[model samples]
Target: MSAEIIETLRSGRLANLGLLSDDDIQFAEATIKKIVNNGSETIRLVFPDQHGIFRGKTLSVHHLVSVAANGIGFPSSLLLKDTSHRTVFPIWQKQKDAPDYILEGALDVIACPDFRTCVDFNWASNSTLLICDLYQRNGAKIDFSSRQILKNATTSLQLAGYKALFGLEVEFQIFRIIDDALKHDQSQMPPTAIKTENITQGWQYLTETRYGEVEEILEELRQASETMNLGLISTEIEMGPSQFEFTFGVDEALTQADKFLLFRTMVKEICRRRQMHATFMAKPIMPNSAANGWHIHQSIIDLNSGLNAFMASTDLTETSVSSNWIAGLLHCARDCCLLTTPTVNGYKRYQPNQLAPTNVNWGYDNRGVMLRALIFDGDPNCRVENRVAESAANPYFAFASQIMSGLFGLENTLVLQPATINPYDVEATLLPRTLGEAISTFHNSAINRQFFGDDFVDYLTIIKKAEWDRYNSRVSQWEQDEYFNNF
Candidate 1:
């Protein structure tokens, strides 16, 4: 539209930076033009932070070319922040084990947009959206980025001539916003949660009336998801107040991660416009609210034959590939628990007979176990569903942990134990019951040290430990109720 912008685009600054492939440069130019012509005013350049929250800057349409040529600058410390927005790393200290990155004083980092992830947001002021990848100002890839970490984990599988497929069975809650927390005192680190009331009295799970009660809002979300190409398979009423479930069609880990984050953002945006609130918190603080779980259904495909690699082998003497995968998942369940259930509140979901697995064992079609092995003979849809992850877990990191664990099993030729009939009562190890336990297990895990480098493992443990420390410092109402009267 502008002569200056056109000249900048033709200069090939993006190509010169080695940020995009030749094909991506062409696509990026086209996408820029398309966004301008499509009447979008602004494009939000977003990158997922350490907590899986999108954090980035917005650029006017006129600056697209210039910004694309050189990435938008953001604080490198954004990636180092805990959920409370405090930079947990001791950047100010020069101790021997201090992190290698220059993170002090919230220094600058660059976010390079990925043209392939561009999506038109017809709902948000008719704007375009593109997710970015984090890079240092000097152009080095940021190792702590959740997306990059996941990509690194998948490289081993990709080189081994296999591709992973992941399906989503995530649950969340929606409430009508009674208070938006706009008052000055409400604003704080992490902010006070808005006051909300449930849209439906949701005791009858999957009943027709339960769905019909909130069908209008649900349809709006479904249609918005379709527009963004998020692959929404179905929506169902979950078994708690204002709780719901969304199942997505299977796709590769990267695509699924992008789709899920976008979907979560879309739901919040849409609900906000309608004076409602949507939360993916593992367990929202409400009376009798059921916790949400993110059940990841994973399977591998043979790159040569394009067949499901998890299918049970017909041979009697040889253990099935599915069994080995199960064994690996169980072995690493404790180590990876921090990734799958990151929040202090998330571990509350691990209870027996709640359709959330409490123990590290596999079972056939049983929802009570951590890994549910579903291998129908001759059925190509066979896969294992890991029920250990909470809905609030970062999708990229969660999937990466799974892929890494399964690869460990396949590489080591580990043998699977017999499937469990009594998932809770069995002698198998129980999942970490608290955030503190999860962090300790993850920090001491050899598998984590091997799969994710020591730097990353330490980085993650430090941030999570910060969160746990904050939790421990606060005295809850339960503590007051139990101690004050007795003391």
Candidate 2:
């Protein structure tokens, strides 16, 4: 805020924060100046946590140049919090078991601007928002940060001479607000779930009239997505009450993940403004409620030939590279289930005959199997769509799991089984039935340890297990109804 502080920051205050390239430093300097000259009032410095939620600080325009130069400081405990806002790690103890944590006593973690990810938040009155990367005081990247983990996976693919492109077909629900818990006591850590009523009677399944009812809100979302560069392809009414699906065009895995989070946050904020509630929860507990799934369509590009690497030949006799990827996905699906469906509620969507995959199998353009191959012999757009993911997943972790698993299959030259015609009846392993099972599978996975390192795997397991423990401790209505009176 002071001239002396600005002068000190501009004169290399962030030089010791990390190893920023000259180009990056220059970009930050110029961007700050541009924002100042544009009369921007605020700058939001945000970082994606393990749950892919954006948490950060807002700076007055006067402090932009100084804060951008020095890097914004935030408590590292933000990364330690679970979905319930509980700090899972034992920070008070010696913490020798958790070495990755530098946040004992809630120490400061530096957040530096990712210059490439700067966006003007036009919906928020043109305030600039810069996505940040977390670092220790010594400049080491936070290994467990969801964005960094995704970057690691993408980098591995780059080294393997391939590029991954991902598209999204994510389904969610929207309802008219009945009541928002605004009482002081209701402002608990995770916040109380707001009560909502159906926007439509549903079950119409993409009918014209069903779409027309919510056309205005859908259009508003589509336009806002365009403003944020979300590459939206289509929006339609899904089968269940107040359910909707949105499709996005293909992009590199990292960019798609960022866009997906942004889209989710944007939709929720916009809907709230309209006195409606939009949720990406996999399966909201209601009578006859349909499950929401996030189907990711992916393909790899050959760096050498600049062609779709999955296409082996038009003859259709030999096994294509894509098949190997599918094999890997199936082989690793169980172990990686925690990454794709991280929450307890997510596992509830994987039910038989529910338009959600329950087994580890692939099929030719079949939606029932976990992996649906839409490959044509000569089509450049041929790709595989993974249907195992839930709408509530952190896109970064989910995409990272896909890349790592597929890479393993490709590298090992794994053989594929015949496509299953009846996905439910096939002799295949069922996916994990609960979050606890998924965490156990992930923890003991040799392939996961080999790729993600034991530290990363263990770090995830500890936090997720805490959530599971909380759930298990609760007394459910089902238990109460069956035992409360009878027992």
Candidate 3:
């Protein structure tokens, strides 16, 4: 009966749609055998949603044999949630010519498992986790899937005979939990913020003394990452209080995106167990708080020649490909700001002389520039670092924005503006100073529609618009302090 069920799933819509390849089938069988032999009682079937948050069902070990091939069915409404976890789309009040699956009465969207992404759940005893990509019931790919967006972007790059690799520098803060904030009044659609105090009074960057203070927690996090194979290269103390940064090894864009999401989830789980809170929020609203940034180190390879495409042939400093890629990033920086930053709080981190870029520009090994070129004489590691993204940005979307924008430059053979010695003072376009400005810029861009399909552009726009509206409608603490006393 078990064998029959497994075969039945392997022969289902996935096979018909040509998604269940021979390799995929073999991988699933291997996973089942490993799970059964290891006595794993539960399996976490998960996929990153629109915001790249891990969400899925946990199933029994007995069902793994079948589910390994069949996958989990998640409500389509899961894809429509904003950052608040509130379903932003009007599913019940569906409009004419709306999306066919998501927001259409919350129909089932299949979470197709990629067995290659299986990892041992070290935090949970005898549990395993597998990541997935979303698909419609008819086996068509979900246009709005965060994973699929990166997949599509990568696929496009491949079609042009180039492949992209990315490395991630992730920064976040960990604090001692003062209050769980679970009282009646604190409960809402989005729960109230929990109170936390800095564990380290950190103004010292990468000081050994400071590292010794939190070595235990950092080691615990490091071990968890190692067990899950998250490609963690190093963990170091960042410039601010209780702020830490984890840098990972380079890999293909899509694989890195998966690891990035899992790493974020793992950090939170490990921290919360110790009565601590971990936040990737770009700028935490606290005294003397330093902002977190996600600096993406990216490079492309020419598949035909099997060489680094950005390598300068004779030009001592930079190549045409790298220049065009930089220009593409700068050109689309305004339009794709919503994808990179994605939050009202994110914009607050872009300040002059703060190890963050405030304007659209690139410079050679310059920390302040938006794009920092790291090219050396005939080194295989010639790459560009994009520093504009917040640590909280969705990895898939941010990487997609880079790939799509870089491709735009390569295809058009655009030239970059001269590398700025003084990035902040250079004649360059400033990044959107507010989320509202970003939304308007993205909404007006024809390029956004050209890259992400019309469906996704519209879907994301509505979701972001809802978030912006929520942020604007609220009478903030500033409003109360500034006007209440005077008025």
Candidate 4:
């Protein structure tokens, strides 16, 4: 407790709290060297909130060691908020069902920078962004935090002698702003949607002319992605008006989540600075706008042999690893929709024949089905693409849903159903057609309760139901057209 002990370079609150390991301290020492060597003036500490939005504070490089050792603090309620930045939980009154740590006056949570995640954002020469791990004052992980959920799933996989590889196909739209919505009335919670026009005309899916017109901005995007080391695979003009897609190369589950969130933040910032708007909403409520789908490509690796589990010589069946995984996915697809399609707007992407899924089914290399198997002979890179999610889904939860469901299948030896040739006309169970349906399905799922636990599931469904309740309370245009006129 003496000043001399406290003044020691590595001794601080986080160290006394026994959260940061010696390796973490050593890593911090190395990071300080990097800041001095690279001349970074600011250190950005960030964590992905429940909705995958980056929230954090930037510190002067002079205090990097202290911040890294003692850890930066932020209000815990950041994770309890809904997408609209509204606190949905009853934090004021302690509930018997919820833990005191979460409801204790919205206490400060500690954010310790992960040295391995330290990266110099090239464009921001003066700043370094480090993804942090959130912990309680008692140094326990926040079980419902996006990173913790994904970590638990991955740990389960590792314990079972397997690993997960994940790749992402992200689709979003870019628009020319018609109004920035700076009026006083627009400054409400979450702000009003800004008015926008398409930067390009409709219906040119990857035509060179369309790419030619927007090549400059496209290059700008490509450069920023590459600079961030996001493992860029390819960028393409999507089927929708002014919509674009970017695919990332496969990586470990956690790394891919970080890259995905970073990409989302980067795209929006870069576009807004250029007097443009970039939207990752599942289906932006705009005329002629196409729904954006986030296709998750996943495969498993055996820890013993380090071989692709999906690369089997035998045909996919109940005995095949890939089959077991896919069967798990199909079994839980309906229940997990709340996580994979986490927004009221995301459900609109499920229309028939829109290159998005409406039914819970799988097919071999099929875009029409919910799960598309790409397993082929002699292909070590085979994976199944889950097209059930929208671009706005939180990558941590989305990836965890895959790991958790796949583990359930492997453990139970679940049998894969026959692949459907006609997904639109199949007798398969339907995906939840609306967010309300998703909430109900998720709330009632025993398997979800088992995997994510009752506490996390209830926390999520409660917030989503709040959103659904708000949506239903509002009078829609269709409701006005049908009821207001008819009544």
Candidate 5:
């Protein structure tokens, strides 16, 4: 068993191992010394589910031998589900067609762990951690795997001789704990709370005093993040009261998504411990409060020469490859709306005077436009900023969609329309008006189906439709007041 485990670790096919028991850790150490004679007690196994949530069970160093003997088991339905915990697909329906199929049985899937993300599991009840990839019973890769999806998109770019780098700027609202009163009475109407600051106002944009007010909370968050190995860049006070923005250093797609999920979990847990609340809802409040957006900054690098592809030449005015990349992003703005601003509430942030883009356009260093080209002439590390995405978007899916759309643009040499002087007044293309409109556009888009694969496209659509139906079935206060009196 030790020999087999050592062979698997040395193969380099699996980068990380998971947490194990004390006995398992000892066995793994012996095996490692025998194989390479240099034992390192570390492993990481991570599995990202349909909602892009990382769920996994880790092993200790001694358990590596036993883990190699038999793979860990996880629920098969995790892949074929939606956010509501409903199984979106008819897995059993296919079994009837193929009598040999036996999916109703608790499907056993293998978790191929990655070693690169291996780190200490100090946050867990047990000291174990590992990042794993899902493989089918037949050893085929799971189609709905979020990591695989991002990997596929990145591979496509690599084939085109370019590598992509991702930076995430996430905004979320924080609320202080008050009485246990319901903010909304579902039986009647959702009540709104008036703004009253327990602390002083006028502290904005990383002000020293602002950090002082929230020092204890922010300090706890920073410590938790550091302990968990989450690469947090900085945190700042946002426009709304108690709203905050957290930034992280740029990384690969999968790593960035993993880090983002970790950050969210850390913030929520730490806030709960401190008797506070955090929400990523795009527009938690309407009429007055500022809307939150997740600004994704991405740059492509050349694999061969290790040069930034989005960089401009010494002469700034000359059109460079970076311009074409920005053009690609702007060209696919409308079609990519479903992935970026996914939820129904996300559209509320796209209003004309909301400081969010209402038109499909790009401009140099412009925040109003959907795409912002942030590269200067002779700057080798230039990149583009996509401001269209809402904070509620699934990072993996959103980033993957952008990669595919941008790749398509690059492949076809898509030309971008000139930057709008006034994006609000420009007669440029508009994003879908509603969830139904976005769904219809996505369903009808052959290009989208082709890139995302028909199975994935169909499954996602079905799940989204379920959510939409649920929302549509609900009665609103406006409907009650207008119709109850008249009819």
Candidate 6:
């Protein structure tokens, strides 16, 4: 391991560390030494991919120092892939067409470990964990690195003397594992009985009996979160069968994203050990069931003044900076849809009267609106809740997109439309109905390109277009059933 990792491990105060750099590897080595003392010699060097899946290699403690110094190697092509793991970029084709250029085709990439994320492996017998960032051969950050995008966005905000504080309320489904192979079949996996039992029994809100039913599972998650030093606020049974909602305390935007990713992984692993499966897919089981969403609550605090910019007034009113912020979120709701609800399945949740917003509108204490203002007159902690993102969304990209959009609104002093008493009947525009439409809007937005950079936007468009193309080619059951019988 590097000297920094060694020093980090020796400190034993891992939880309080900030963003990790190459110098922190000494601290990590000290941490590893402590783990070894406890008799666990295995460590997983994991990194989040484009789809937010954790991918990495597990190394022995004996090799930690060497791996930390040199970094672990992964394929460069991983960054050029879509959600389905298809290489969307035409790197090979371009190289083949131009033989004079030096294109090694499949080059090796490195994942530099982030030692500050070092946490004890709750599920492993004797192991610790770390997250990494992918780096190109020339030591340049990959264009599609979600974590890097968020870091860049934070840097912009910090430069303006403001800080982004984020809190997440994410919903997901948990199913009992009946059979390994059969469970892989999406149709038979959710088990309708699970939903019927939980929904039909009138478990609309959190109650003692409902909590008792899943006490053991919830307990395990709570313990695991505490062990990992995750700032977990609360977790409650959701509306759907085996569905649950987890909330986290407000933190810096990037740190909150990391915590969210780790917490989701922990819940899935713990559920699996108990013969259960947890899915973060936006609309896993369609129709008849309420869709799951990841609601993001955000605010901007003045770094110099130490005041929340989104809060106004000593009493609830019609005018405030908070109201203007809500206006900004609603104004860019259509353009922001691509980042918030990026997947095709995500659009299915925007149905009328489903508690999910279908149009770009704001309302006070209205969950049916895309932007809900949560100011209680003089509450300093008041902020805006954006209820558009799907659970599968990359938090970094999603949060960064929102920050840029809202910042634009704030800078322009945009006037928001009047609050709608009935969001469904309001005259506001609706969000993009499909991923294709959302991508089109995103690609056409000059402002978005200006904020996120032309190269990054172009790369994202190409990759996501490939995903849409792949999805379009596959014939769905609806098409087969409808056409096969009629035609």
Superposed on all Cα atoms, the candidates' RMSDs to the truth, in angstroms, are: 2.0, 2.6, 1.8, 2.4, 5.8, 5.1
Report the lDDT of model 3 for residue 366: 99
Backbone Cα, N, C clashes tallied per candidate: 0, 0, 0, 0, 24, 23
lDDT of 1 by residue, 1-487 (tens): 4445445655644446676665666777787878888998888999988788888777787788878777788877777778999888766655243356646666777888887888878887768899998887667788768889989977888887788999999899999999889899989887987899989888899999889999999999999888889999999999999999999999998889999899988998998899998999998889988999999999999888889987647331256666767778888999999999999999988888888888888888888888887887788998889999988888889999999888888888788877788989757788999999999999999899888888788888888999999999999999999999999
Model 3 gets an lDDT of 0.87
Stretch of 10 with least lDDT, candidate 3 = 310-319
Candidate 3 local Cα displacement, residue 255, angstroms: 0.4
Give the per-residue lDDT of model 3 (tens digit) for 60-99: 8887766655667899888888889898888987644347
Q: Mind giving the per-residue lDDT tens digits that candidate 6 earns over 413-435?
A: 67777777787874668889999
Q: Over all chains combined, what TM-score does candidate 5 have?
A: 0.82
For model 4, what is the alpha-carbon lDDT of residue 405? 90
| Tens-digit per-residue lDDT, 1-487, candidate 5 | 5555555544432223333344544454453444233243444356777665677765555665445444566777666655556665566556332222223554767776544455444443434455676776555666657777777888888899887889988888766666435456622322333332232253365677777888777777777778767778887877766778888888878888777776776577566566676767788753345688999999888788788876534222345566567666766666667778777788878888766888887777887878877777677657888989888787777888888878877787766566666767756788777777777777677777778786666666766776677668889888999999999
Candidates in order have lDDT scores of: 0.85, 0.85, 0.87, 0.87, 0.68, 0.74
In model 6, the worst 10-residue window by lDDT is 95-104
What pairs collide in candidate 1?
Answer: none
Report the alpha-carbon TM-score of model 6 versus the true structure: 0.87
Model 2 lDDT, full chain set: 0.85
Report how far off residue 344 is in candidate 2 (Å). 0.7
Better of 1 and 5 by TM-score: 1
Question: Can you write out model 4's per-residue Cα lDDT over 1-487, one digit (the tens) per residue?
Answer: 2233234435787888887677777666766777668988888889999888899998888777778768889998897888878988888888665566887788899997887887766574578889998999888888988889999999999999899999999999999999999999999987998999998885989888998878888899999999889999998999889999999999999999999999998899889889999999999888988899999999999999999988864377547889999999999999898889999999988988888999999999999899999989889898999999999999999999999899998999999899888989757799998999999999999999999988888888877887888888888899888898688
